[model samples]
Target chain A: MKRRAFMLSVGGAAAGMVLLPRMAFAEAGKIDWYTSSDQNILDFWTNVVKPKFEAANPGVTLNLVDAGDAAGQTAIGERALAAMQTKTDPQADYFESADWRLPAGAADAGLYVNIKEAGLSNYSRINPLAFDGDYSVPYRGSQVLLAYDTTKLDPANAPKTFADLVTWIKANPGQFIYNRPDKGGSGGNFVRRAILEANGKDLGKFKIDNYTQEAGDAALNPAWEILKDLSGSLFDNGAYTSGNTQSIQLLGQSAITMIPAWSDQAIQAINTGVLPETTGLVQLQDLALPGGFSRSVILSNGVNKDAALKLADFILTEEVQSAVLSELGGFPGVAWDYVSQDLREKYADVIPTTIPTFPGGDWEKAINDGWYRNVAPNVDRAA
Target chain B: MSLTPASDIVGKKPGRGLTGLLLVAIPVLLVCWMVIWPIISAIGRTLWLPNDGGTGRSFSVETYKFFFSDQYSLNNLYVTLWTTGVCAVLLVLICLPIALYLRFAKGRLAAYVQGLAIFPMFVPSIILSYAIIRVLGPNGTVDLLLNSVGLPHIRSPYLTPWGPVIGLVWDNIPLTVLILISGLGAVSNQSIEAARDVGAGRFAVLWHIILPRISNSILVAVSFTVLGIFSSFTLPYVLGPAAPEMMGPFMQRTFRDLNDPTNAITQAVIAFAFCIVFGLFYVRSVAKNRAR
Candidate 1:
């Protein structure tokens, strides 16, 4: 009887989530928006999306709130969910979240107004593989590119291929720093893919249930052994991948020679004086991994759907795409084909969007392929 | 408060009716809402899950089945248990000697040494761990020095399953020292003088007299260190190898990033249950000791 009462209480609490006020008390005209982008990007979003978007559609407000990176997004999302659970509406209207966060967050919070129901009729051109494409859309892509400090090496000594990078790591001891796969998202994921590729393993034939411990171990054995050797030789003494801002600073400060970084992130570092502008980037010879794209998820707080659509469409248009490309170092989508011609000639040397390739593996097939935890030290060093 | 509590009705004074009620009610209710509610919520979320394990659907024992059914997990459990157990025993063995020395020694040097012994506690564990790695790891300063001297470079075995034991012991020593120091002070001076007058040797005095007097402090320190190591994740995760291996690393992997909250919950449940079982055993022994 006691257990039943307790469980019933729990049910009542959960059902309470449904009773939250969906109404906004903000001034009658404007729609509020929130995003977890960088401050610089937030500046861009508000500068471009708010005033221009608001003027174009009168009485509409675009409130672009910057909520930092993935970690920051998770914290803010939790707070919002807690506030709403107590019969409150979130302060911000629209939120942008990464692909990994939406499933655990948006699905549970019940915050979203289904884009399909809200008259968002088409997004077929965007890769539907985005987190099973159940919620959210592709907003911005953070491509994994190989970037090196010019002060550390001449062009002749610069890394070109996967093999060249490995050789470089080995030759220069205690200098290489890749984020641990389980801790850092961008660098860690890319490194895991690279390890899989380096070993020439098949990504598709992996089964989870009958996953042989030995087989999985053997598959990653070479990579582990290689990493073990490189631990003292090239890896950071601290044993953690640099924090995102710290990584950007490391590149700017020329503390490292070669690092795996998002193309835009690398460019932003250079533009912000965190990294030298002379630092260059290159993609690996064979790998063309999936891009990490951020999405703008519009909430249906009784806002104008047509206006929201117009804003999204305008951002995806050629002129806006060109502006984003020129300012943000963003690679052009099909809409900005005109500007892409000149971009291809000038910046084409660095940014390439030719194909979608991975390190020949799926994360589902290999748990080791996921982001690394910042906790794991170079334990084997002591061993 | 309601009606002067009947007994106090005819007595000298009564409690403040509304103020007292409001104070107790507000804090008790707030505590339940804040801390207790979220823990209950996390545990509750762990228990209930959808059948199909679809997008949001959960698989419950599927997580448990993965953990308990795996041979690797079994090995890790054994390793963790063995490490924690051995560490408790070893911590007593190591700290007892230093504790005994500190108990007897006196003067300015002792005062400085007492403070210095606790210096490790003041410095952050993360910083200390890094220092240990630098001094003890394969290519660290000590090893490098050994190599330069044409000696074989040596790395401590503390990095493996046994490494956490070293860290736990190191962390617990200062605490143990303080506890022991107090217990030793409480030992009757006359009792020690009488034993010595009767021709008790130093070793005999230590074994028969000092140890018994300080047993409570020793038990307290041991229990604390054991519980700490058993529940710890950060040090092992930071200093141990990848999965199919260590408990700390495995718990993090299964639960944290995998979005398999069910598995994380299972691991948590198992840990909670394990801690409770051991805690009860420890308390029972303590009660028995007290009764004696």
Candidate 2:
């Protein structure tokens, strides 16, 4: 090989390596929407959302990537953070079910676009309760509620307050259970409800930003006592389910009559006939069980930032929000008025008037750890 | 057989030493890069503790201290060890009879038994967990059958400590049986015939001849089973109790759910320290076999 030819070949290969990825992203108009949602959400995105979005906006592609779970999404967030700090292509355009505070300061660092001020056309439809922050867009909502087998208990007779739920569990031992608080938000919010009951339902005590270990322990100690007192009423005498799905499965099998479950998962299970047709959902009337909204963030250094923002705005539109209710069995991120009237009437039975949420951060971490340590210390070995 | 070292063999050939070293270096470097490096990095992270208020950093054992001092952490460790020991015993009790039958019994039944013994190896752990749940969980197949027969509700082992034990023993049966059967191959038919000729009964022959020769295989099987069960996450996470969880689920909860990575690493370090004992036994067995 001649020296000139060898150098030319090497240079061409290097340039191709660098420019090929950019060309693919630009020409393909690919927007990678990484989500940590479950199989049903992924199915809804692939089957319904992807096709409609691509048809409406030709030359743009929405690649839905399953970001396994919370931990997996956190790893992706960390990688994006590193790419942003280094001024490199993040390879990630959108993050679904993630928060602006993931890499611990990416939002404040101006690494994420402020979706509210981004002049999205459908910003008027955003629910005030679901409007979490400036740097992220809330796309869908879900909350924890009591799921009961209607064959075992009448829907009208279901427990309406936290106190009534506890009384019902004690009245019918081994007919109720929740998952471990560390495993899913269903059980986590159940524990949170207990904390509220213990503290006179004061939502003001727990704050996301100002968390002190001393105050948290003081608030949580009473809640632990209440939970421990009601432990024997749980399935298998305090053997908690591992996660949300297991609790739902046990209910489906008629092993347990009632459980705290995520509204989206419960409705999906009922709609898909995984849960029995007799299954019913209800919210506590005295103090609403805590709910959460799944947010999507657009990274500033993402390879296709404009396409990602467009997708984000598209998710908040009334059509997609209505699909979130009917197809995915999740609550709409938009206001109830913005959702389709018939679909809203169909789900009126489970629609919550208020979506109270417990603060995360040190408070959540402390509650989960303290639950394992104090409330559920006794191992329920099978007899 | 001449017991000349490989070094001597390479020394006698020209340029073979370099080729042999390169061939060995590839796997050696790969193991160092993949396995040993991550382990060392994890251990360093556990020791790299931040001071109070996140002002300064220093190498400390505070996380280990927390693990040892906390009763909940201690309970998790105890449950993990208990589950591993019980599964090892169950695997042996279940697999040994099948292995012995496969070794001596020659018939279609033996072939079917071998096939059944190795079936779980091809099944993934997630699928295995689901199968176990369907078969043994509440209102599952067992309950349905028992209820149909007018039997009272059976207390299920699922979601209890015994849950992981049952799942792990079933998941591990194939590997243990294969190892034991391979070990039983060392016992020749001629030797059994010779023992029988001397008026030794089957029990006597098995006790004197078969069990003694298969001791190394048994050790290797137990070592591998212990290591696998001790580090297992899926079965335990799905089947085991929420409190007093095995180290796998416990570490996961500490890291992901509880958002305490430093303590999670400490838990991993401690779990690794426990598995190292079995790992050493495995290494020594391999070394002894090589020495022979």
Candidate 3:
């Protein structure tokens, strides 16, 4: 009798172990948030956002998984797409910094939730320009700005236009630098700004969906010529920094006087003492530099869809959006009217009126590859 | 008469052969599953590229044609080969002397020398790259020293082809020393003493006696160093120049940044083809040693 009772208890316990997460989800559901964001942003989410969000809604847990790199994030997207097709649990609640139109047919198949219509109370506060397609939520934005050391060059004499910037580069050789286009956004947009100038500031010529091989080649030729002309005036005679941080480091090391740097990164560097306090940031006046937004999309097939939607809505509230600026060194997804007056007043000199968007699909690939071939050819050297 | 028969002692027993097979089976299966299958799959993907209309997939060599015909890709391949060759030669040159000292010298200082030689193994490659930049880049420690003495600044290797070469050589020294020291172990001291008694100089003893015995080990070290340096990514990415990158970074940029996986896989397959040559040298040396 004792043996039979023991067998029955074992069976009951095994069933409970299998079904508990599903049955008790309303009481305690863990939202698996997948992201490829930088370490500081992850820290902001973990240390600042997670605690507050979890406390307000006691049962829901925000689990941040640092998906290592771009490839890891892409794999998560593919897995979500696969689960949607098979009508199974995606095991993922949210994906950060994802290209929403990926996995080829994901958009058509409705793999991602329509985030704008997911019952977000703060939906009206989002900047209309940042609200792209409404399939993903744009939480923050970053633009490339001209970062210069004040001691080396006075702020009043800084270049106000792309034309002025070019002349300045020519006048002060080895005093300016930017990273490689393929490596970081600051350099990529510096190249893009040049392209824009080459095309007579015609933004309409470049579109999100419009890039053919022949068209891309013809459009980029003038930009290459412009870059090649300025190559001899650059730091170390056309040597580019490897990435965003390297450009900032060069300024810190007093190796260069000015560089094209991401606004968020430059600000963070100054705040963290990586770059000196004298480093100043300014945007171009004639034409605004292109910027990118970090967007998060919800998986339709997620097991914790309702709770994930709640968290997604919570992310857009003024509280979290304000912290994104003060703590994380990022631009708010909401317009300046919704942000705190102090932040607006403080960053008035550097904040852009409008963040121009650049097509990341095919245009970026063509430009990066062309830069290596036409602009910066290898120079022979002995180690 | 009391002992077991000669056949029982000399021949393999049925259970013993089964145990040997069992012992080797797990690792062999793991290698086939983990390493071999992925390589085959990657090679297969490189061949079946997307069609021109972007509608269907078919077998094609267009990616290979692009890689071979493109000057940029060819230059990257050339840089990778040159970097590997230089790092291998430097590693052998630097590590052989240290190995000989550790092998022949006696005292606590020799132990300390061995410790210092193996120190790089513990430092991560990323940290080593940053340290290299701090010590050797513009306005760095070396430049500051030069300035203090009223000398010219260094032509920094931070963003040149030599940048990755320096980092890789430093990163590879520890393993190279260990291999060389182990190889030097087979050289008995009595032979060296005999050569000394016959009036042979240090160079002659090394060339005629020590080098011949350690030639296989040197080959092993060079082969390992060549393979490691050829596919190295972090050092090359962080330190090397933007244009004409090594094959590792080239493949990565083509795959991730350029969004051209087919071309990236083709680049990888080409690198694999080059690495196989050195791999064969390692295999041959191992086979020769086992025979001896």
Candidate 4:
């Protein structure tokens, strides 16, 4: 009798030990988030978003990881790809992606969980154009604009067209700077606009389904010629800044009068006193600047799929959208009617009636390659 | 000989063999897991093409072929080699004299110079790169100083290869100095003094006695500098020109910016090949020293 009792107690204890963790796991789940976003974004998500999320969904913790060191976005994409290839769950349940990285990263790799299929309610609020085919929910928008110091250059006299900008660059030598095309998207946008002006072709022709070498060569030749001609008039003759931030810093310090900048970044810099308050941004009337939307992605292979979808949906909420605009100086990802009138009016000038998207992946690669081969050498020689 | 029991010798062999196996097993396993496995994986990745969007994967040497054939890629390799060679030579020239002075000279001057030499190691490379840009960029501190002095502001080479070379040398000098100083410690002061007393000139003592003694350290420092500079990304990325970029940043650009992992892996493999060639010298030095 004693032996049977002891055996029974031991069996019960073992069963309890096994079952307790299962219950706890079901009760308290975890959501891991990976992002390459800057410090402000990280802080806002941690301090503001995390607590609210945790409060809304009881017994869930959010873990934010900085996956953007020396490796940058490639490392994050590679890890996601490896996880999919191995048929295993990815390390992070959700990923924060920039506009430029989303298409090549999560969309290309097919790593994102389809929020629409998952029945996320707030997913419908996002603009259909911002959707990368059910892979992402657009969170914020940024527009590439030409920034100038009001003290140095008159806003009324700012160039209204690409041709006028080129003429202005030549007339006011050593006052304008743009980053290397391959280095920053703002500079690349400027180059793409120049191509549009030079080619004088329908913009729709550039957006091809597949990349053809011959088409790319024919399209970029005129652009190379224009850049080569303008090389002599660039800051310090042809010494272009390496990145967007450097160009902004030069403008802030009154070293250069004008440069291409992201609208949100310029506003943030002005707010932070990194740039003078007199710094102003403008979009040329003839040349439509490239603008894109950043998205929140849920990994297809995430361990906590339900929670991940919830988090992604939560990011698209009006409260979070307003916070994105107020805190990050970013435009709302939702339509204008969804946001307040004040927020719309504040960013009215920078916001366009229609956002110009990138011409497709092939054109992007072609521009970078052509610049390296044809335009860069001339720029270097001119310098 | 006396009839020593064969069983007695055989009896101790098992314990001794077990101990030897444990000692060998630990480091062998470590090296296999840490070094060999990752290298094999990276090489495997290069062979298997990444699934680029809708494109399916297949084993091919096309990536390697592109790397070898492309002029831009070739220029990247050349730039890396050029930077490594110049940094190695310049580091040796600068650090050798400082090491000699610190080893032989007495007083606060030597101490002060030694302190200054190692000071850069404390400042982070990212911070140092920014500082270099601030001090040397157009209309920067150098230009400001020139203007203050009522002189014309001169253009700085901060946007060219020379800029990165200067930053790399400044960043690497501390490590080279420390190694060379340690090497100098092996050369006894008495031998140098005795050679001097024997009517050998300063250059002769250096060439004959000190050079031979510290040759291994110099080799180590040069190999390390070459390896570090070849794989370096920060200084080159921040300070070097956009075109004719170093292999590190070029590979990064190819991988991240261009979204071409296959080509990036190929570049990495080429860099790894260079490292292996230089690493052999370090292994040889260690083995030769052990033999001696």
Q: In order, what fnat does every candidate score? A: 0.03, 0.52, 0.46, 0.14
Q: Lowest-scoring 10 consecutive residues by lDDT in candidate 3 chain B?
A: B1-10
For model 1, residues A257-286, the per-residue Cα lDDT tens digits are 777776766776787776787787777666
What CAPRI-style quality would you assign to candidate 2? acceptable
lDDT of 4 by residue, A1-383 (tens): 23333355556555545644352111227887777755556777887789988999898889887876324654665676787889855566777763324435555666777666878887668866677656667888877888888887788898887888999999998788788887766787888778878777357767646558888778789789999888778777676677777777778767788898887778778888989989878888875777678777777777787897888778888888877777677777777677777877776775676667765566777888788767765565434
User: What is the lDDT, from 0 to 100, of the residue B61 in candidate 1?
Assistant: 54
The TM-score values for the models, in the order shown, are 0.60, 0.92, 0.92, 0.83
Candidate 2 at residue A128, lDDT? 83
Identify the superior model by TM-score, candidate 1 or candidate 4.
Answer: 4
lDDT of 4: 0.78
Q: Could you give the DockQ of candidate 2?
A: 0.31
In terms of docking quality, model 4 is incorrect
Query: Best DockQ goes to which candidate?
Result: 2
Question: What CA RMSD would you report for each candidate?
Answer: 9.6, 5.6, 6.3, 7.8
Each prediction's number of clashing residue pairs: 21, 0, 0, 0
For B1-292, candidate 2 gives per-residue lDDT tens digits of: 2233553454354234444454455557668988899889989888887788888778898888988999889989999999999999999999989999999998899899999999989999988887888889999999999999999988889888988899899899999999999999999999989999999998999899999999999999999999999999999999988788899988888888777888888998898899899999999998999999
Off by over 4 Å in 4: A1-29, A37-40, A51-59, A69-87, A98-111, A117-124, A127-129, A380-383, B1-69, B106-112, B199-204
Best TM-score goes to which candidate?
A: 2
DockQ of 1: 0.08
lDDT of 3 by residue, A209-242 (tens): 8999988988899999999888878888778888
